[model samples]
Target: MQIKALALALLGAASMAGAQETASTAMPDDMPPPPMAAMLRPPRPDSARPPEPPRENIAAPSRAVALIAAEAALAQCARDAHEVGVAVSDAGGHLLLGMTMDGARPGRIYSGSRKNAAAVAFAMPTSAVQARLQQGDAAMAARVKPWMVVFPGAVPLMAGDRLVGAIGVSGATAQQDEVCAAAGAAAVKGRL
Candidate 1:
């Protein structure tokens, strides 16, 4: 039994060695490596690749501008006797500034952020998005991502024909929240 085991081990080793030798000899030394071969290959024709979407030079609001927007929204909510959270997001839906008023619910901050993201995604106010959803627009409803909020509390910040950022407010009635967000956008209108 010991002899048989030893013989099998030797046979396996011999087969592996033979396979390795065969593989090595299959490719010439002058041939480039796999990665280099890919690099050397010509690019696929334009028709073979999907057309890329047009690129736009969109700008994002600066930190100072974002802060101004958030402060303005918060102040508007306060003036309406509402303690709310404010969130300012860049065009790419990244938080640029965030603020929560005293006595506001902690979840209001998250709500504000989600509203901002939704506004940016739809390139319009969350109120419009909510209206569309209510009208049973299936196409628009399908575009609502999990991380987005279609509530009426966010407004996009546009600089001329370009979108720069968005502001969102939460903790008040939907209309009140949208009013606060519009105030925020107005505050930084010239700067954005």
Candidate 2:
């Protein structure tokens, strides 16, 4: 009986020693590493780009050519319908030129200018878009209606697959507005 008790005590001590060894040194090899996000963070929301940049060979019309066309278009529009409002924007929707007629009402300039922006943004004629919506196809036009004028006289300025800019002319009949926009686009075609 004394031998059995000693054996049991030795067994218990062996188990205790094994448990301590496991607690002190054993590692779980199957455990997965932490997620990458938890390990490292990305750049801040407002970080500037690098100093050295590679030049891209994006062949587009010159700003001078676009301005010259815009000027001629405005001149032609003034001759035919008098000055109204003309807005011009670059391909990415940046306004490069904005003008209101000598005696135009307030907000007319913005409305007219945005009309051209709408045309370029949608890559379609505003008149056509209006006609589509008028015919109950507002599904597509609705998407761009938020940022563009549905009324006539806005035209997209395209330079091949690239859109160069847009021209919006307003302050007259829809037809007159369209004609004015058309004239401006025609003047810029050389640049496009």
For candidate 2, write residues 1-192 as lDDT tens digits: 799667666666666666555553222121333333323435544556455567444333467865665676678777986657777766654566777767766776677666765676577778987887789876765566344568888787877667776777777787788888788788777567
Could you give me the TM-score of model 1 versus the true structure?
A: 0.69
The sequence of per-residue lDDT tens digits that candidate 1 reaches over residues 83-158 is 9999888787777788999999888877887888889888999999999999999999887776688889999999
Tell me the lDDT of model 1 at 104: 96
As a whole number from 0 to 100, the lDDT of residue 170 in candidate 2 is 75
Against the reference, the lDDT scores of all candidates come to: 0.83, 0.67
Cand. 2 Cα-lDDT? 0.67
Winning candidate number (lDDT): 1
Instruction: Point to the candidate with the largest TM-score.
Output: 1
Error of 2 at 45 (Å): 20
Tell how far residue 37 is off in model 1, in angstroms.
38
